[model samples]
Target: MSLAAETREAVRARPFLRDALRAGLVNHSAAATWLAERAGLDGDSDAIAAALRRFREDLPAYETDPRAASVTMRSGVGVVDDASDGDGNRAGESLLLRVGDAAVVDGGDRTAILATGDVDVAALANALGRLAAADVDIAAAGVAGDALVCVVSRRDGANAVRVVEAALDAVPVDEN
Candidate 1:
């Protein structure tokens, strides 16, 4: 394809680049040079810069939509391999989730932050990003239907809950 097409594809493949372009926060010439090396685009730097300029015009402005969700924290959660001596099948302390061989069971060393109500993958993604920025290490995380859950160390539970709530309040959405 043309250099313009290639540049567009490269930017779309990198969300940060796309966001920068949409916000008009990047220098076209510098971005072109970076893209040439990063995306292996073979073209004159000036031409690639021109392409980036054009591509930026085509992308929609960046925006965020608040997700209506309630966040809650639950302690004593842990992840285990469901196949381990059938311990994951224990009664009373119910299982939060089981994926493949791994299962998040109740009553463990970790804490779980659960967000329900109009929550989806995007909300979860935003929450995860905020959690990472806050230096909270996630043990297990998932979003299905209206439920979004993140398992983290017990010490980080309170901070993770706040980050998740804030992230859900302004989940990013890029319109095309």
Candidate 2:
């Protein structure tokens, strides 16, 4: 089977894998390592690389400003066509907040950072503040395993890395 076909088959067999890959939260190397570990098979770096490349290329095009903040779902009262609930509450149903679908977001010229170590929230907040201070807009951020994955504007990727490194350095190391 072709690499693309194999990738699609693998993901189709495991929906969670597709969700994870589509989320764009995990790095290709990390995903490959995980797949190898999960399948109890030897790591095939070449196959992993091709699979990831094909998956990315298959994603839909969604052009957006790298500096623009990602879309966030806001919860509010939404009208329901059917009154499933006997009470009038059905007409005023509460909506749940959800994160934007990463597949619909532009990945071009975006930098993905996967930092593994002590992921201190305070340090992360500080790093975010520093980015804000520098006007480096954060597109998306999520915690994947021991690493914090963040997507930011490519133009500010280098600066973001430097700022995060400095922030991490400034954090006090606990002597345990």
Candidate 3:
């Protein structure tokens, strides 16, 4: 079986990584190399990358009912959707600017911070650093269009929102 057919368990175990991969934040080649060394999986980087790309593309379609979903493959080729051609090309993609104020949501065991409006990557980085400094355990982080979404320990959620706000406010506005 190809890596795509055999690697579902391994990929599903690292939910955060899967999210990052889908978001185009993780490099596919590097991930393939890691899989080879760590999981004893051997395959061409391009092939593995293609598989990962497919995995990412089909992921959202099954988000609500992932267990009931099945991977549809034929002749070792996966189906492609119109929104994503599965060509493994992201050359022309652009980041969306976040808008509005950050919101903190409590999810019992965890807290989530949803930030929007002019979201600066650097500011988000700084906010993450601040969270790290405070020893807050971040469960996950992702960029969804104009939103910078982050999940931290429930106790740290409100503080995390403030940290993001402070960092975003500190960015120097362009006069031009």
Candidate 4:
């Protein structure tokens, strides 16, 4: 049987594997390692790679951002339709606040710090104020780093962006 057919069978047998793949927990090497460990079979790396290739080809592709630093804003309302990206594609909309230690993997060790969160404007403003009080510099804003992401649920979707923008704008920008 073909590798794609085999992978489909495997996924059908183990549905969790699909979630693992979506969550980025299992790639080609990882799957091989897992199978080798579980079945006590000496699976070659080449076989694992081929299986992964087949799996990818057989599955429906989902849109994802490759850049690690992207910020996404999503609404809480379940019924709100996603905005069109102008290319007949509906963008994946999710509100996420993320903070991470930014470091270049290929280059020498240089790093910057980042903090993010998806929350109500009042709460976000309060948090920002505290950070400002502690002397953290306000960096970028507006769909980028340090930018305020506003997501409106289907119920409150009409003024989501405006509300978020206003709250973010109220914060003092450091000109230094």
CA lDDT, every prediction?
Answer: 0.87, 0.51, 0.54, 0.40
- What's the CA error at residue 96 for candidate 1, in Å? 2.1
- Tens-digit lDDT track of model 3 for 1-176: 76887555567776556656655676878887776667666777677767777776766421211111111111111111222225533234321212232222221355556676655455456557677877877765555546676667656766776676665655422221
What would you estimate as the lDDT of candidate 4? 0.40
Candidate 1 RMSD to the correct structure: 2.2
Error of 1 at 107 (Å): 1.9
Which scores greater on lDDT, model 2 or model 4?
Answer: 2
lDDT of 4 at 146: 41
In candidate 3, which residue ranges exceed 4 Å CA deviation? 61-134, 137-176
List the pairs of residues colliding in candidate 1: 76-108
Candidates by lDDT, descending order: 1, 3, 2, 4
Worst 10 residues of 3 by lDDT: 65-74
Q: Which parts of model 4 are misplaced by more than 4 Å?
A: 1-7, 22-25, 39-42, 62-176
Instruction: Choose 1 or 3, whichever is better by lDDT.
Output: 1
Estimate, for each residue in 1-176, the C-alpha lDDT of model 1 and write its tens digit.
98888988999899889888888899999999999998999999899999998888887877889988889999998998763446546566576766777878886999999999988888888888889999999999998878899999999999999999999988878566
lDDT at position 145, candidate 2:
34
Q: Candidate 4 residues 1-176, lDDT tens each?
A: 65445555565466457545534456777776665565443447567557765675555433222221222334232222333356533345422322232211211121112224433334355334443554444331223444343222233333333343333434322121
Alpha-carbon deviation at 125 in model 1, angstroms:
1.2
1 against 2, candidate with superior lDDT = 1
Q: Could you tell me the lDDT of residue 122 within candidate 2?
A: 48
